[model samples]
Target: MAPLRIQPMPTYMDIHEIPGGITADEVAKAHAHDAAVEGKYGVHYHKYWVNERAGKIFCLCEAPNAEAAMQVHREAHGQTAEKIIQVEPDVADLFLGGSEVNSAGAVLLPGGAADARDPGIRTVLFTDIVESTLLTQTLGDDAAMELLQIHDSVVRDALKALNGREVKHTGDGIMASFVSAAAAVRCAAQIQRGLAQRAGEQSNHPVRVRIGGAAGEPVEHGNDIFGSTVQLAARLCSHAEPEQIVVSSVVADLCIGKGLMFRPLGEVSLKGFDRPVHAHSVEWSA
Candidate 1:
């Protein structure tokens, strides 16, 4: 007989969009109501984020399914989420960070115990050295290491300036997360321009990098960020040409009116994704 497979409870992040704006106190009350009724549907409401200025509320929960999670909200406070996406616990934690909550169940900023709230959204960026293996073969290990060092320094500098957190070093490049999509876009442009300047200074072993970015809420899969957002960012990076920056439509839309120039690439097929994803190329050169 075949062995039975047990399905794990799925984690979900739900977004509530309030037009004018919402207060932390109001969200706290709604969360209390959710907690009161979640048990009935076997849903566990973990933590929530309130962006008063953005008029957005994000709730993290685990339930049998998205519908079950939404049912809890309907029963609890009649505040249904505008959208809900299934996420992995670890990925959600990576982007959302520590789970410290106040007395009202709202998540606080990593170290800020005072009334500040985390918005629960992040823009993930990936940078890859174009033809890294070929470069290593042509330049040998020592020279390749030097090129990598240059890439590291330039990317780190831009990250520091833009308030981006380096998630991990990708050997040939870096992976970072930012609170603002515009900042992420700006950082990518800076990295490209910096590399171009460096190439001009050094004729031999010119380093060219490809960058990609995508914006979304926290979703986890494994120890690293293996969510769709991260995947999209990585795929876009791979799709980019040397010295080019590619980003998802979501990232481009978020940067609207932010003075960033992007040429739409229409929809492009990517690996591991069922449908084609809309992409844009950032014009980062002078």
Candidate 2:
């Protein structure tokens, strides 16, 4: 037998079809799930399009291979995949590379006016209340909303402390942006620890929060993050345990020169994104 020849991971796309009549509420729920899984797996290029004409849902993602992408979809939402296709990242990479180059060429000093022509790579933080489903089930709907208001308030307070901007709320979840990867990770850990303290004080109803982050050039849209990087951050938070913070290799790369320590969790190929993205789950308070 000849020596084994290792093959390069084939870049591909995974298409999943969600059920028809997926309501706005369902889309919100599904999007949350998608974001969380994407974050956990580090797939930074995902686009969703609904096709009512064919009564099918379209999800375009970059992945190392069909198998890896399929695994992501299955593990993320337990959804059965419909189609998977091979792709050449070279073409898309050219476009992505150009964007990065343009961003680097621009000089945007902090607190100074800068053109919105570039998509500057930055860290994105996503935080959300944990066990929200059980809470709503136990507490009345109105009471649940009131509790969420308080939870949001606490989160906002901490975010403000860190000089972060809230991207938006996906129901109980909040997406935030930061200039520094270390700061974003630190802020996430802080929120988790602080929320845990608050939860410990509540004997009847403890509220926990899960946090995750990714650092990359997130497409900016007003105050919201609109790129695959942002989606990946939210996905990481979704898969995270209460008070746990998960980060991507992109974030890990940014903190290389910095002194922040990280515990590596090996590699995971997220849905729709080509190549395996190294992942790390930051050590937080037990």
Candidate 3:
């Protein structure tokens, strides 16, 4: 039997908070642009509402996938989305669950439902050294250690500026989390750009770093993140070129309608995963 299709199309939608100096009329034009792109992709876009208090415009769209939907938002709008969330495959039906079904899905005794599940909405970031093994072989332990210190200094400051929480360090790489996916993307980009500038100033061998990030539910345990989703984000770091940021569809969706840019790399399967994940390379602002 063929699988059931829930939504007519897969779309990434969000609520964008308009930056100061932008008028509602301007936002309407941007929304119209997004509508046109959705039509080109064979999807319908629904303009939900305009928040007068917070100065935000909310929209819902349907597209081929999250990336395509995000592309529409990024290309069409210049507003920063406060929250871009996945509507989920079958969110409506899930709400139909009664008390018995709901209780059955609860966490183990005393753990509560929270412990068994992640909030399902978080920004996951991965960072790692570039050419560490070769640098270690050539520069030896002493010099390599010094470079690592520089790497730490660069990322640590970027994370702080972005208000990110340090989850832990995976070898030379660090896994961090942010409340906002936009901040995570911006933070990673800033780190890379900062390191590049710092490297140029130093006369010695310049150390470079690569970063990867995703936004999704990572199993949370006592103020730390765990589970396969987090691992996938960490592994994505290796796939990134030096000074580049690779992010998953999850993160891509969360940044929709934000002024941020991205260049799609299509999709690729990560190790120990059953399916391929859509990934993108962050496009730096001009």
Candidate whose TM-score is highest: 1
Quote the lDDT for 253 in model 3. 85
lDDT of each: 0.86, 0.61, 0.65
lDDT per residue for candidate 3 within 100-219, as digits (tens), equals 212222112112254232122557788988888888999999999988888888888998898777766676777787767888899998888877887888858787888888765322
**TM-score of predicted structure 2:** 0.55
TM-score of each: 0.71, 0.55, 0.56
lDDT value for model 1: 0.86
The residue-level lDDT of candidate 3 at 7 comes to 53
lDDT of 2 at 149: 78
In order of lDDT, best first, we have: 1, 3, 2
lDDT of 2 at 281: 86
